[model samples]
Target: MLIALSFAVGGLLHHLGILRIDHLPPLHAHFRVPTFRLLPAAVFGLAAAWMLPGALARLRFGRAIALGYGTALAWTVLLAVSGDGLAAPFTHKEEYLAVLPAVGDDPSGWLAGFTEHLPGYPTHVRGHPPLPVLVVWALQALGLPGPLWAALLVVLVGCSAAVAITLTVRRLGGEDAARRALPYLALTPASVWIATSMDAFFAGVGAWGVALLVLGRKRWSRLLSGAGAGVLLGSLPYLSYGLVPYLLIPVVVAVMVRPSRLTVAAILAGAGSVTAAFAAGGFFWPDGVLATHAQWAADPGAARPYLYFLFANIAVLALVTGPAATAGLVGPIPARVRTVVAATLVAVAALDVSGVTRGEVERIWVPFAVWVSVAGGFAGGRAGGHAGDRRWLAAQVVTGLLLQGLVASPW
Candidate 1:
């Protein structure tokens, strides 16, 4: 109903010329006629949705991770191919690869002047910090140059976010909860965007950062985990300023785990080192944010109606998370996991009203979307048995396939 209302109201506003959504209302995509190419992904998704819930529950933790990650990778690739082929990652002129040549051999030099170059760079480059381009640059440096390799790299990292989310759930709610959530985590409508967007890359990084922090709260591994989380979290804002809201996730984890003072220091140290390195390279994070804001203000897309987007953004979120997550949001969530869910909702609400994120949140909010999808686990668990779980999982899979087949994403 929320999704329906967003589209109805948003479409009305767009038709009335009061809202300037460039593509579709609530999504930065257009309608497309799906071809025979979609059949393979559709078949695979249905099979996985039907089979994965039981398998994830019965398999050992290691095997479940393998199955979940492998299936997610295959699903994302198939969906990407079904919609736009392998070149989809670089097909858009505004993507990071188009701006890679500007960096040349001196990444440090590029980082130093990133803010100054914002006005002239393409849309994706201008909006983000230096990490996305640097990631592709690093891949190129490693002999994996060109769009094909970059696309594969993005898919590989993006799919791994499922593993991270599964681990976090296991840490917080126990193995059963993790297993219950694994299928939904592995099969999500967000995979439509995960196939080709840098936002998916950010989702993977942020998810792992939070996962490590949760997993690292033990006495023996606290320092190591905290430091690892710190580096990933620290690098997040550099990847995309919009990801700043994700910082709240770790705070939720810390409160739940109650880490010692030393662990806190380690997290701070890890994050601080990344900040220090960027500063040394002549890029201050705050100034970069200000510059990006100015660029965003100048972009014509900023003319989008905020009042409409406040609810429409959440509508896109519902589409990405699917019906199962919606059921979970209102269903009986476990006490331990409730805080994480609450934190995620609060973050999304904050982003929605901030006016910084007007639309296209389907992809931009992928990080939070993963956590929100965790609710599907509880929804499945309470739905009776494995059959109920499979039904919910299938719903999520169908949502992804339908979106991939029907929507032509700009990414």
Candidate 2:
């Protein structure tokens, strides 16, 4: 039924003229190299064999990491190689790719004049904050090549997010929750874009920052976690204007779960550091963030009739989240985590409806999507309890990947 539902959704998207056919470019032709196509399958087969012992029984943290990133890399690389073979940008990667060479040439000038560089409303460069550019610039400085570096950075950040999600679940629930959640994080339909966007890195920083704050039950840990969360959360608005709303999630978690004066103080201080730095650099948060909307409002995609893609993206988000986990969101859970999760969902839903994210939310809503997957751990049924349940999730991911690969839509 879920498979059919996914196909139906894809069919509907095709009918709507959203998905189109494309001729394979010379660069993407290498994916047709028969040997290259076989490699990902071989890698996955070996990983499943290695992880079978741990996955079926204890699901240890180390094995979970292996399963998560191993699966993530296999799936992501397969998608990338299949689509473009790492030669051309994958869906919206141009946004991040545009800024790197400029940043590499003059980091200070870029920082000071980033807002001024926005040629118009919805300029690709204005689509995200400057942090990703700095990170990519540093990678380029270390001799990594163009666009490939962007891809690698995104994959690394995404895999780290998987680890952070595991840790957060371990803290809130237990090993069982963490174990059940890892696979979902690893192979969600979102993986198609995880290596293509700076949003994945933003999701990682935000996930770990909040995870540390909520999971740190010890005093010293709380101090460090709080401070780290503050810095990341503080940096969120700088990452993207859309992310400013997410600051509420960590703030609520800190206040509700582990309210300590020192933790709060550290958070404030960590936030202050970025604030001070950006201020020193002449980019005030309000002024910079407010300027993003001009491009957003001006972008043709955002200017389209909202209802056309609004419901479609919502449907895609649900499918990408997997049917079981989507079902689980409304099911039972521990009160504390449930509250956090529910609040996060409300924020995400509000954003979805506001037309700010008119379309492409499967990639755009990644930061909130991780939390939704985590919250699914608390749902009524035992996660992955049914026999062949993992197969079902795998099928969901595979189906989505095929749809994405076949479609000409840009992420």
Candidate 3:
């Protein structure tokens, strides 16, 4: 009973607090996150879900909460290695470069805030700031240390995703579908793109938030889940503006049409907090930020179109807001609501395909991709099939994870 209560309480706290912590830091802070990408964890996040649902499910409530928290922390460390510790893609480099000039002429000034800076650059942040920045910022009000912040990030950045993928796969596709889907993610180039780029974790937070909301069984659970999703989604643009289309577009459409109060509240709260944070950080809407980003991407390696990338994202928008999302719906939302989502998705797809999809920085589409991958798992589950095939598919995903873990960067 205690364990169940803790899960309920912790769920509420995690859901509510992520927004508070996620909002505290400056946008540029995330650009300097340390690289700690341990691709094995990404692989684990997908691969472990099959086992965990049972293991954690069977545990005492306290044990289950403890077990879940432990897993969350462990995963954060692995993903952290890939983010800020390494170099970033072209459009992404600018987020750091903008602030670089401001802090330039005196590298020590910036270093004062961080005792251990990334190697190579002179007073420069390697990639986007670690996902922990906002989490730490939330802790700052409580006087948490950097190392502790990093550890906390392991939970916020790591488990949010790991559990999300697990639940999404299980709920949508079932155990069989989840097992089948694991292998492909292990070797995808996009996964490589995601881990290496710093923005992936923030996007993961957003996705998990959505997943949590969907999985929540009670009204309070729904509220908390939505809150988590809101914080994660809102945090994305702060790390990389490129994620907006994927993160914001789908979320808006989903919320506009969804029947529940929790989902609506989560979106509103998270977005509102982020907006307040952005304004507080001085990145006013309709300001030089847009103009500056436009000019920066105009050069070589500019935001050119990637057919696969667009197709993948379009598929995600379709899956997330389309029939797949409908599958996640428990009670029926109004017909008008579903119609609006359908229309909005169509419009976004039109804009995305027409080469209007510019200013895309790094793998900004990752959050959406995460959504797509989960949606795929769901869609795969919904197909009229058998238990044997599902298990076979899951075995393949598990095998892929093992193989990818042995090789470089498991996406």
Candidate 4:
């Protein structure tokens, strides 16, 4: 119902000429000639939806992580291949790889002048920090070059977000909640973007940062885990300016866990180290934010009507999260899980109302989307019961397959 309403609203806006999107409303995608390529993924998703919920209930924690991650990875790859083949990651003109050649051999020099050269770069490059391009550039320097390697790196790392989210849920809500959430995390509609978009890489990194922070609250590994979380969280701003709002996620984690002062200090030290290193390399975080904001404001796409997207963005979120998550939002969730969901929503709402992210949130907000979708784990009966869980999981899988078959997205 929410999904249909979103499209209907988007269609009306498009018809009225009030929406400035280049592609279809509510999504940055076009209707494609339907293809049989989606059939294999459909079959796989149905099988997992039917089987994994029960199997995950009985599996050991270690084995569950392995199985869950492997299944999620396979699902993302199949969906991505179904849409654009192995070349999907680099296919878009605005993607990071498209502008990799522009970075040249002098990374330090480029980092120093990133803001000055921002306007001349491609759309995706100009709108983001230097980290994404730097990752691709590092791959090339390591002899693991080209779009295929970059795409593989992204999918591999991106799919791991499922594991990270699962771990965080387990820490906060217990093993049952974590186990229940696994299928949704693995089979989310968000996988459509996670398969090919660089934003998926950001989602994975941000999720693990929170996961580590919660997991690190223990006495033995506080320093190591806090430091790890800090570095990953700190690096997020450089990945996407939009992720600056993502700080709320970690703040929520910190409050929930109530870490010792040493743990907190370790986190600050780790984050400060990244800030220092970047400053030494000439890419101050504040400059990147200002420059990206300027670039975004000047882009014609930013001209879309804010009034329409203010609501339509929620619709796109529904599409990405699917019915299970939507239902879970109202279900009886654990306080910790609910708190995390609330924090993510606050961040997303802040972004939506700010008029900075007018559309394409289906891909751009992947990091927050995963957390929002965590509500799905609580939608069914208590941890051990299968009651309504499988049905909702099936709905999520079908939603992904339908989206892949029906629309051709920019990712």
Residue-wise C-alpha lDDT for candidate 3, range 317-376, written one tens digit per residue: 322222323232332323333333344345456546655343232244444444433322
Candidate 1, residues 253-318, lDDT tens digits: the string is 888978789888999999999999999999999999899999999977788888878888888998
The alpha-carbon root-mean-square deviation between model 3 and the true structure, to one decimal in Å, is 14.3
Point out the worst 10-residue segment of candidate 3 by lDDT: 22-31
Tens digits of per-residue lDDT, candidate 2, 1-411, equal 544554465456555655432122100111223335535633553354345324634655776667677776776666666655543553354566555656667787778887787653124567766666677678778888577666777778775787887776666666666766676676666666665667777888888887878766688988898888888888887777778677777877766666588888998999899889988876777767666776667655554445645555556566556554576677655556666677777777777677787656667777877777664443436544534444545454654455445543343
Write one digit per residue (lDDT tens) for candidate 4, span 1-411.
665777888888788877756467888778887588888898899899888988888889999889999999889888988878755657677778777677778889888988898998888898889999999999999999888888888888888988998899888888877888888899999998887888988999999999889885456698899999999999998898889889998998899888889988989998898899899999988888888888888887688888878888888888888888988887778789889999999999998999888888888888988998889877764642565777888899999988888888878
Give me candidate 3's TM-score against the actual structure: 0.49
Residue 49 lDDT in model 1?
85
Candidate scoring better on lDDT of 2 and 3: 2
Clashes of each: 0, 3, 30, 0
What are the lDDT scores of the predictions, listed in order? 0.86, 0.64, 0.41, 0.86
Q: Candidate 2: TM-score?
A: 0.82
Which regions of candidate 4 are displaced past 4 Å? 217-220
For model 1, the stretches where C-alpha displacement exceeds 4 angstroms are 19-21, 216-220, 381-383
